[model samples]
Target chain A: MENIFRIIVCIKQVPGTTEIKINPETNTLVREGIETVINPFDTYAIEEGVRIKERMQQSGSEAEVTAITMGPAQSESILREAISLGADKAILLSDRAFAGADTWATALTLKNAVKKLEGWRLIILGKQTLDGDTGQVGPELAHMLNIPFIGYASSIEHISGQKITVKRLAEDRYETFEVRLPAAISVGKDINVPRVPSLRGKLKAKNETIPVLNIADLSMDEKDAGLSGSYTQVIKIFTPKHVYEVKMIEGSPDEQAEELFTKLKQLNIV
Target chain B: MEIKVDKTTCTGCSLCKNFCMYDAIEITGGKAIINDNCIFCGACIDACKFKSIEITGIHEKNFDFSAYSGVMIFIEQHEGTVAEVSYELLSEGRKLADALGSKLYGIMPGYELKEKISGIFNYGIDRLYIADNEIFKHNIDDIYSKILVQAINKYRPDIFLGGATSFGRTLLPKVAAIIKTGLTADCTALSIDPEKKILLQTRPTFGGNVLATIITRNARPQMATVRPHVMAKEPVQNAENRQTDNYLKYSDRIEFLEFDPLNFKTKYKLLSREKELGQSINLSDYDVIVSGGRGIGGPDNFSLIKELADSLGGVVGASRAAVDSNWISYPHQVGQTGKTVNPKVYIACGISGAIQHLAGMQTSDIIIAINRDPDAPIFKIANYGIVGDLFEIIPRLIKKIKNGKGIT
Candidate 1:
């Protein structure tokens, strides 16, 4: 075993698109039946982690990579999916006591799990989950763990010993940063394309038995977890009060152009 | 029952004293004396100096918020893994639990359930309902819907909330369909209804043109999906799981196809990626904002916008017309479907008052809009609106603010 850094990569599954249809009868999204994919952003985290691990091994450094996931009983598939991506190990944080957890709570759980992994030197996460799109957990987790948080990382620049640097993308510009090890880095969807699992990797991951943890074993109680421990409350969910149909004017190119100019003239659009 | 009173204009109006039967008020030193016993009634609000008495409604008309209820969060997981939005939802859920009385529960189904359920507990979820089954694994529409459909039927919860995630955005509709109910999507605000026993769903319509509050009148389980980042995340003071439920059984009706990993090229890619080595979408990751309006003139002048954004280490934003006119790129436009930004600072340049534009940035923490016209509708929402030419104002203002230290 060489001195490659020990890293943990976290990923999540999500709906792929924003323009989804709603079940008119149900008044909710018509997800009952559509395909769900890994959150586009989280895949970047997996890719970056795997790349780092691969490079470390190439350089003759011993780097151990693992995937961590927190989800429902059905979510183990995600860990298996992570394993197929070349992670050496995967851990699932499951328990009835961990339900209804918000961002801070979720990060707290991840932090606790990482704490148990003695040699963890880095944690990689997606810039944001497509579903909530809040992008708050990485920073909050970093703050909680007293570690540095690098957000919106577009690419990894260099990694040497306990010092690591990355190029963070921020719309038309980039900021490079150097931080200590064991830090959390949130990457965007464009970071890299996650490759399909190889047959060998798949076979190994399929045989690997992932472990699960609960509130009791985590030394946490249900009283403060889930809804109780969260600081903000969602009092209600309702449709917006405003209602006005979009009336797009359509016609032949000339006619459409004429109508546009007419409306512009009428309203002095210019 | 929290109240804020302006101390300067209090004329010792005792009407508040008469209205508060809870003995939660005081009228010491010529101001309305609000005590702990005051029950947050608006009776005294109509009787104060310059009508400074504003009664904020903390509770809605559905659930009795003070009572203990299970922290029931509609899990927005992807392929069985928890989504970041789920964490945000849990953060907000935890807060709601503390405000009223409740425990957080993450509900999902699949076979061979893992410990992801417990991970959420550290985020403060008190319980998990992990129903393991094959159909629940792939987010199987019919199977997953039926499972939640069955679960809700059995659990009979007071409230069920999900994130506006893609899965949530898609699956909730189907689950609600299976249950034969209505669901609110993209809610910006949520409140508990003390009497109605319903979930109030507020979503913007006409592309954020208007905010509508919807309520499921007769549904058994009040279901709604909240937009991400709309609510503040709560910190995990401590974590503990109160209870957890295990698999009772699995249904064979649902088939799970362990999804073959996605090939990047097969999926819908963005129109184009940024050419610069270190570039990403700006609006996707910013806390403060400084936007530009038509006042700068012509799309070419947008370089001014870039300069300003660079100077402040912030993102540049534009009104609807700016994008429609092709003056700026599409990514920078802020509107209903265009983008929903809640930055700490929003600066509007030369843009006139347009409801569509206002719909997008009005919710910003602080709005500083500039226009030659003082009566521009933009000024209505602006904490600070300037009436001057952008050419004359921006450069000078930027220099002044940078040199003086504070613009406010």
Candidate 2:
């Protein structure tokens, strides 16, 4: 057991399209017929996790990658998909009590689930989810677990006994940092290109049965698992309205180009 | 929380089903039943006209909030100068502090910042806390979060604000989690709730298609990170006026703090730092930007966008679609997941604007759209729209500008 290392990748299932529409009468999102897929950013995380596992195993050390997600029962599809992408095992944390969890509660639930696993050395997640678009859960989960976190990691340089070096992309510069083990990292899309599932891997994944964990399984109290544990609540949700007065420059390409240049000049733009 | 629907009141008209974005409501046997998919967003409760859908079990917890006071903002600094977003936070924080009848404070943890401390007061910060040490030089999350959590526990500010920069987004959530509080990210709007006397943080979700207003009722210090350029910076006030009104010198307002770096042991160590190469031009810093999208056809066509930008003495930007297709690098991407820019002039070439792409550059002073499709959504938000092939129109425009013949 001491020779084995475990890498956990946290993922989410998000609506596949950005063309979400609101019902004109009800003024709410039309979720019907919308396809769901693993968040695009999380794909990079899964790839990086699998790459790390392969790199370590090549050196004659034991390593495994596990994919974890918290969503509806239907979300098991993504976990299976993760298995096809090289995850050795998958876990689905789903319960009626886990509904309405904000970032805080979501992180707490993840913390509890991670604690249940043995020989875990590192955790990986996407920098942010498309649907929530809040990039807080990774750092929050790390804090809850009392470990260091590095966000927006562009590359993982090396991993050795009790230490890992990661390159992070900041607003103005790229910084390289060395962190101790039992740390969490959230990666952006630039890290790696996610690989397509191999035919053999897909067959193995189709036959794999992912274990489902609920709040009770993790020994988490009911209040601390879902909406009751959430610190922030959404007070209102509405569609944003934009108003602009546009002037159409209608003519031949030359005429339109001339008019655009003249207008930009008038505005002192170009 | 528990949600229940009164079978007697539910007409099975399925009105509530239309409002549920989660697809949790099912009209089973002429009654609306909520399944496990419900996130308890309360949207159905509002949609039900008969008040049939109700959520219970939201009990108020007993927590003492009176121990917290004042509004505190994290002043982000790199090298020796303060980040521009910090000033914007100060300006917004000042308003929030004034509205709550509380004092506005700022916290800066850096090295050799003695000379730069007083200038921040011009933005209406009452007291600035300094943790000037050599170890505070780099923006290390492990060390910074520990220092911040210590400061937060000791000072206990009612409201905490930070700019939604790369550093803030990573650091604040760590602090919030350690302190067991709620934190809202990339807030576009902040105001004090008149009735509850609490902070209401509003931000866009679902790729800017929806806006959600959030509140932390029981948390000690409600935390929020605001996006840069979304809020206006207040005009800098003269030292004479501020000193005369306060009857105190700038030095009197400074509070120097001491912390033992060894106590906050962190396994994190900075190995190296380097500037991003190749793309030296920061799109946000430029006044004029020329962007291309999927209609640019391929990566090779980005040269046209770059040529036009260079001719205009601006920079090149790209829509998410173009970046996703590898037509351009991620640094040049402008959208929800990318940089939010507010340049003086924005030129869209061959870009059928998506809502996510529009969220980043809609705030530019002037927008010019060039697309073959007359009904492109970009035209709706653009000030001047040219319905023509970008390949032709852009070359002509660039040739005219390069010829330098259309003079004043």
Judging by lDDT against the true structure, name the best candidate: 2
Residue A184, model 1: Cα distance from true site in angstroms: 0.6
Q: What DockQ results do all the predictions give, each relative to the true complex?
A: 0.03, 0.66
Tens digits of lDDT, candidate 1, A11-107: 7655443333332343232222334456666767887898998887788788877888776555677777777887889888876455444454566
lDDT by residue for model 2 over B1-408, one digit each (tens)? 789999888999887887676678899999999988788877787678898988889745888899899999999998768988898999999999989999898989988886766558778888888888878888878778877888889899999999888899999999899899999999989999988789999988777767788999668799999988778888455644443322135667778766887886776888998887776346776888899999889999999999999988888999999998988888898887676787888999988988778878887788989998998888877988888899888899888776654563
> What TM-scores result for chain A when each predicted structure is judged separately against the true chain A?
0.90, 0.94
**CA lDDT, every model vs. true structure:** 0.59, 0.85
Instruction: Score residue B210 of candidate 2 by CA lDDT.
Output: 73
Candidates in order, TM-scores: namely: 0.46, 0.93
Please write out the lDDT profile of model 1 over residues B154-268, one tens digit for every residue: 6566567787653454456555544534455667776665664344555664344334455553344556778766776654875544234332222111222233222111111
